[model samples]
Target: MTTQMIIRLDSETKTKLTKLAQAEGKNTSQVVRELIEDYIQNRDMGSYIDDLWDRLGKKLKARNVGSREIERAIYESRASKK
Candidate 1:
């Protein structure tokens, strides 16, 4: 689900943004969405960690490492900490 947000910008800024967005073959809203997504991806630690884990999972799968190996590793790691 998506919600609407209202932001206030000066005329000059709005005009420039519109022109740039057009030049990039996108609407102002798309540009704004991209900016917001990038901002969140940069500053959100949870998002960063989730992406990291996703990449790691992909690499492990590529190497044919299955859930059993992952579970064993996790169990071993926890045991080592005790």
Candidate 2:
């Protein structure tokens, strides 16, 4: 069940969208739908970052690497650049 949406775009934006659609062999509506879906998926990036950090912590723990060691290595690396 899909609802029809009416949007207003300026001529230049509409033209660019139409060209992009044609280049991708899609209609403007399909391209717009895909772009909207991508935007929706990435909107909750905080949760994504938290999950990423959790996974990284588990991996580091398995390798016996503590956060203090990681911070020291980062500090050393930054100091070497100066």
Candidate 3:
């Protein structure tokens, strides 16, 4: 099912959107729809951070780095700052 929406944009923003739509060979509606979809699909910060940490952990484990080593480094840095 399709629904119609009405949006109002300032003149500059409307001009920019029009140019972008023309450059991409899409109608303004298609560009606006894609932008709205992207805005809706973006990840929340906690999930984004968890994903980053998971990737970092995998890379660190591949290089044989352990949590204790990381903890000791953190402690040493904190101690030096004291």
Candidates in order, TM-scores: namely: 0.74, 0.52, 0.49
Candidate 1 residue-wise lDDT at 51: 95
Tens-digit lDDT track of model 2 for 30-81: 9989988888768878867988999988999999998899999999999999
Model 1 C-alpha lDDT per residue in residues 1-82, reported as the tens digit of each score:
9999999999999999999999999999999999999998999999999999999999999999999999999999999999
Weakest ten-residue segment in model 2 by summed lDDT: 39-48
Off by over 4 Å in 1: 66-82
Candidates ranked, most accurate by lDDT first: 1, 2, 3
Off by over 4 Å in 3: 43-82
Question: Which candidate model has the greater lDDT, 1 or 2?
Answer: 1
RMSD of each: 2.6, 6.8, 4.9
The residue pairs found clashing in candidate 2 are none
Q: Which ten residues in a row have the lowest lDDT in candidate 1?
A: 39-48
Task: List lDDT for all candidates, in order.
Answer: 0.98, 0.93, 0.89
lDDT of 1: 0.98
